[model samples]
Target chain A: MLILECPCCGVSGEETEFHAGGEAHLKRHSVGSTDDQFEEYLFMRENPHGVHFERWRHNNGCGKWFHAARCTTTLEVFGTYCAQTYEPPKEIKDAISARRPGWSWRNFS
Target chain B: MFEAVSALQGASFNAGIAEVRELGLRGMITLRGDLTDKKLIKAVKGIAGRIPEPRTVALKDDDGAAWMSPDELLLMVPHADVLSTIETLNASLKGTHFLAANVSDARAVFEVFGPHAREVMAKLAPVDFSPDAFKMGMFRRSRLAQVPAAFWMNEEDAFTVVCFRSVAEYMFDLLSIAAQAGSEVDAL
Candidate 1:
């Protein structure tokens, strides 16, 4: 019944066509060089309310992944943007890019 | 405007395929993008003159409806110029963050007109079919038998219902039911 606006498809379709991808901009922790440190970094989350980012998938239409921001209570989507272009907040981006004392994308990949 | 199909008179449906007998009345262009793209915004403004007002229909001089949003807008224009309009709008854009598509084939529309159109709508749609509740030239997303559709009344007694192509057959069935109900109600 709710007309969900798909950022990629450019149409207001039934919410059935879309699959909420959960919080959109969850940043991965920097590589922590050591095995124990990396494991801890891999599993952490701060599910905060009040202006949080979430991911949504256009499962029925374009088959693309995207991100959106919404109110936790009312489901008023404030903004939607492509996941590819998602620019995490400066603080989070910096924290992840720093790569701790010795971590990188290779360890997990 | 969808092509009017053979009406099943025994059923309660008034097919609006009559409206699409030629080309169609409304030419809908779908625009998708991140609202943050200034270039895209500027390009749309350059062509359309002004962006659609938020969550409302923005009508320019032409009989077009720009259903505005935080990210997407459906630009409805006179059906004849759909191809040209898409080209012009896309040409004006310098950025690659958005796509403007002429999806005339993807949707089937019903241009239901006449005095009893509202009566037929009541049975077809769940929302109040009153002129005051819907007003003229305003659209809302509703369903014709659980199918997603956009409905709006342009002039008094003239309503337009647009739905995706996949559900067109199902909608037509429901329209028949509503049309029959409309005639029955009129007799009373």
Candidate 2:
């Protein structure tokens, strides 16, 4: 069982308590945008091999959704943060950088 | 023309009552607010005898407040006190952005006790139920038999399990089977 720590409740429980909500920090291309842009918004997703960020809901636990920064290959959770924010915190990014040097994800380095 | 009945009212289980029993008609309320607010803390402390914290259960008078999340609590009282409890919480925490609602009928409550209680719970959930890990006053929200449920370790050998009313019967059945002697499994 994959253990996940809920930032809201502060409980680190099994994956069964959480629901993966796909990629995190996506820019929404909306109404006035071109069809290609809208399609990218709806269909494009990053399948990263190393450092990645994703959204997950602690549906069975605190019932709060949060962001998880993890390594895709090794499943090492760099950190977890509240989902209310638009981007992962700078310290979390720095931690990732310290572990995996010179790695870039989207706008973050 | 009708009255509400418990999920296991007429059902029978082979296991002894000392190990487990249905705690019917509990007054349950889902309370949401800012825990850090001084007024909110004092208000909840007035109601449940102490400020509730995440993963812990606090008792006030005869009521017990089980922590549901960072901003949510499950307050359990006698069935008759349900309405008044909501009113008290609202009155005490006025002006703050808070929500207090009675959900007494939405779920069923079961009390598990005696020597084999931990073994029974182990069969169904993945929670840490050992003495050092899951102690009295600690609560956990997780799945039991693939159904959403929450359980509180209320004492040394006692715990409370609450599940949706619709699936209460199934939950009771699963608990009964798990309660059988020697049907034990390891829980983390």
Candidate 3:
């Protein structure tokens, strides 16, 4: 079991109590961006093999949503923070805020 | 057609007393939304006729209790009242930002009562069940055997344990384990 550190609670808990969000720091494109740019934005994900920041829900515990920075290769969590306030990758954020088709928080936030 | 299941069978553990017979419990509804949503607040108030006072569980005229959470609440009412409650809520809600779903059938509840019930729960859950910490008319989101569950403690040493129906059987097994643990503790 992965021991996740909650930035809010300041405690490390089992991964079952938490959920993995996704790559952090997505950039939003400028308005009137082309379809190719939009497609690239939609399909491209930072497949980082090392430390990555993602959102994890403490659903079984505080029932509060938070973010976790962890290593996908090792399942080693580096840090955590609240989800809403956690900064997202500029591209992903722009796509999400733009309300573009295929852009979603569920797949990447 | 419905029968009351004992604590060891399917009883809800209360905090103040040993036990009280519960015929059937209300369906459990988990309402999730931003606490600052005025429209959501208005809708909930309209349906339940005012949310339960802060930190306190108040029942509707029909014996439904709305237990508040940090960002949401767990509402308990008779299964029969669920449909009407949802309809009234839908009519009152102004936006689609809020999500309200009836989870009564999704959860299995067991009422565990008795003076020792609290003690039994302390061993099972990580939260403080003492009156000061848990008190009367408070709800908690906690884990049982690492499974998500909502706990509502009412007066008379009575508490209701609600969890997903899929894990209800597992929780039941844990309760039996807790009861046996209680029994063992008593022996020593």
All candidates' lDDT scores? 0.59, 0.83, 0.61
lDDT of model 3 at position A51: 50
Cα lDDT tens digits, model 1, B1-188, are 76623222112334442221111345778888865677766756654666655435555666455553456777777667888877876776645778888876677676666677787676655556665666765666556656767777667876767777666667666665566432546421
Better of 2 and 3 by TM-score: 2
- lDDT of candidate 3 over A12-103, digit per residue (tens): 45766566655555445558998877876677776666555666766665555676655567776545656665365465344334543343
Most DockQ-accurate candidate: 2
Give, for candidate 3 chain B, the lowest lDDT window spanning 10 residues: B14-23
Model number 3 iRMSD = 4.5
Give the Å error, residue B52, model 2: 1.2
Mark the regions of model 2 whose C-alpha exceeds 4 Å error after superposition.
Answer: B10-18, B185-188
| For model 2 chain B, the run of ten residues with the poorest summed lDDT | B9-18
For candidate 2, give the lDDT.
0.83
Cα deviation in Å at residue B25, candidate 2?
0.8
lDDT of 1 at B186: 47
lDDT of 2 by residue, B1-188 (tens): 77877777645454553366778788899989888889878877776888767788897666888889888888888888889888888888889999998888899888777776787787788787777788877788998878999998777778788999889888888888778766655443
Per-residue lDDT over B1-188 for candidate 3, one digit per residue giving the tens place of the 0 to 100 score: 98633223434433222342332445667777765678777766655667665445565565554544556666666777787877766766646566678876776776666666676676677566666667776666568766887677655566777777777667766765676532534311
Which regions in candidate 3 have their CA more than 4 angstroms from the true location? Answer: A1-16, A19-55, A62-64, A68-80, A86-109, B1-25, B47-49, B52-62, B65-71, B94-96, B181-188
